[model samples]
Target: MIKIDDYAYTSGLKDVHPVEKVSFALIFLLFTIISKNIWVACFTFTVMSIGVLFKAKIPFIAYLKLLFVPFVFLMTSLVAILFSIAPIYQEDLEVLWMAEIGLWQIYISSYSIQQSYELATTILASVSCLYFLVLSTPLNQFIWVFKKVKLPAVFVELMGITYRFIFVLLEKMNEIYIAQSSRLGYQNYRSWFSSVAQLIVSLFVKSMSSAKELQIAIDSRGGDEHLYDVDLSMGYNRGHFVIIFFSFITLFMIYIMTKS
Candidate 1:
């Protein structure tokens, strides 16, 4: 299983009702997205990080590694916003630092810095909120929640199947890579590229075969109609819901206070 999935299944909060986790994550995500003040974004980030690390019992290093993946993308986007390029400098531009390249100049300004900070904090806070939910709630629980919300069966089925396929493909790819490595397929750069190409082709063929086998297995058990009918009901805990409601109120109050 993927690290995230394993963590979710083993999470301290795994026994909590899935609806509570989902509502908490999505509500905080909306708050973080709509928040205008940096403080609000920072607050959301802190709260979600605490939930993931302490409440959910996820390892700090593992969470940081997961967080770093998005941080890299956030930095890439923020770089463009943090710096400006122009053919000629303008006196009113408030350039904090500048470098000349040919006839063009690239510079940073206080305004750009502030904008980048806000964007980065907002994005990070939103991601943290999602991490809290995914780290604490398993995929089957999410599927169970979806069914409870009366989502279309086909959509739910596809989501479950697609999630399973991701792991299947990963398993197949890992096996192929190990086999190739054992055969010295990556002994050199040229062979590395060739091995990767072969691995891709092999993975695709194996995945197709796995899908066919899965279909046969499904058919043998009747069909795909009631495939996901397993009981995942864990009765709701009103205390968790109450805590989330109060948390939202607190965050809303913080947002208002910060706005003024």
Candidate 2:
């Protein structure tokens, strides 16, 4: 039988300790906040790429494909904001110099460069780091780590429930959609809209019914009073520390190199 959560479904980042994974992600966020140098951003990307490669063992092609998701949003936003601003004061800006092309003449005001580079670098780094972090960490482990970090328990619990509920809702919705389509539900625009609305309403009702049944089942099985318990003795292994440490070291080196 084919497993639902197979290699395609799960990221290898789940192997690392949750706390370590989150820590590295936060550090990347911090770097983005403090730096705007293109070289620095490039360096950070290199480090993050390495982290995704070695830490998660994700294929290079997979990483590029995943990276494209954020790149589209980021580049679109960057170009939109940058082009919108008019050059109030024309000054020769030193953009990437092409060999034998002495200082390509481009007029940029003070505010534009400061705004564009800072926004561009921070957004790219943030998106890239977050994508890797999410791919590596399981939703449950991420929540558990957040709790360990002393984040608000209520918020975390709510987020956890919402995350799980989304997939459940999607599964149900997909099933309903397939059944409806098989019955020729989309005969026209009016029919399509009405059918979709009805389908959603049915899904909500079914979900509520499931929730009630689940509650009854839990009560029947002892109602959270030792219904089930797991004994976990998680250890901090060498590989975990090694990967996290190297990520930081590489990040720091990138910062240093870019500064020089």
Candidate 3:
């Protein structure tokens, strides 16, 4: 099982209706994006963090590791936006700091840096909304909710197949790694590169074979026509409804404040 699914199934809120989780996450996500305020985004992240850790019971270390994935990209992108180059001092400007490299100059603008911070916070907050939802609800349940809304059968089927095959691909890659390592495939830097390249080629071939096998298995199980007919019983959680109600109210207030 995928690690994320593992957590989802074990989540404290896993038994709640997925629609509740979906709507709650989406509401905050849209609010965070539209508000365009760093404080609002930070507040959104905090609330989701509370839901994930206290409500969902996901480990803090795991959450940190997940945030690290996006933080790396955010920092790399921020470098470009926060810093600018100029030829000497063309005009009087309010810069946070400036550095002279011989005839050229590089400077960080206070206003631009402030904008970057808010943008990063907004993006990370929006991402966490989905992350919190995914962390609490299994993919099958999520897909079931989409089916409830009448999402196209072809697209839903593709999503299920793509998700199912990710583990298959990873398994194939692992087997190839073990085989190569046992035969001294990564004894040095030169061999390590060769081993990785070979692994990629082998994994590609195996993925094709895996897809074919999966299709045959699916056909044997009465095909994709009945895929969405699986039992996905959902029960309403009154507490979830109340939480979402207040969350929307709060977001509305924040939106008005930001506009003002």
Candidate 4:
């Protein structure tokens, strides 16, 4: 099982109703995206982090590693927002630093710096909200929620199949990678590229074979058109709902108080 999925099944919040968890996550995600207040973004990020690490009982190191994955990508993209290139430097521009390269000038302005900071916080905050959901709720529960909402059976089935396929591909890829590494397939840069190409091709072929086997199994089971029949009924804790409601109200109050 994937680390995140394992965490979800064993999470402290696993017993909480899927509806409650989904609503809480979506609400926080929407608020983080729509609110322009930096304080609100910071608060959301901190609160969600606490929920995931403390309430959900996810490992602190694991959480940091997950966050770090996106942090690298975020920093890479933020570079574009943090700096600008122009044919000539403007004397009146509020630049913190500048470099002259040939006839072009690359500069970091105070405004751009502020924008980058805000954008980074907002994105991280939104990601935290999503991570809370993913870390606490299993994919099966998510499908249950979708079905409860009367989502199309085809869509729900596709989601389940696609999620399963991802794990399958990952497992196959890992096995192939380990086998190759044992034979010193990645001893050099050239071999590494060749090994990666071989791995991709092997994964595609293996995935197709797995899909065919799955179809055969499904056909043997009655050839049902709808594969997912979720009968899960998770009871909601009123206390949790009350707590979340009051917590969000507190956040809104804080945002209003700090809006100036």
Q: What TM-scores do the predictions have?
A: 0.93, 0.69, 0.92, 0.92
The sequence of per-residue lDDT tens digits that candidate 3 reaches over residues 1-260 is 47787899899989888889998999899888877877779889999999999999999999888888988999999989898888885777677899999887899998778889988999899878977998999888888888889988888888887887888888788889999999999999999999999999998888888888877988998884555454577788898889899998987877677764
Candidates 1 and 3 compared by lDDT, better number: 1
Kindly report which residue stretches of model 3 are placed more than 4 angstroms away from their true locations once superposed. Answer: 217-226, 258-260
Superposed Cα deviation of residue 43, candidate 1 (Å) = 1.0
Q: Write the per-residue lDDT of candidate 1 for residues 143-249, one digit (tens) a residue.
A: 88889899999899888888899999998899889999999999999999999999989988988998899889989988855668747658888888898899899
**Which candidate wins on TM-score?**
1
List runs of model 2 lying over 4 Å from the truth. 1-10, 59-62, 85-114, 187-191, 207-232, 238-253, 256-260
Give the Å error, residue 104, model 4: 2.7
TM-score of 1: 0.93
Q: Cα deviation in Å at residue 190, candidate 2? A: 4.5
Clashes, model 2: 0
On a 0 to 1 TM-score scale, where does candidate 2 land against the true structure?
0.69
Model 4 poorest 10 in a row by lDDT: 86-95
Candidates in order have lDDT scores of 0.89, 0.66, 0.86, 0.89
Write one digit per residue (lDDT tens) for candidate 4, span 50-95. Answer: 9999999999999999999889999999999999998774568787
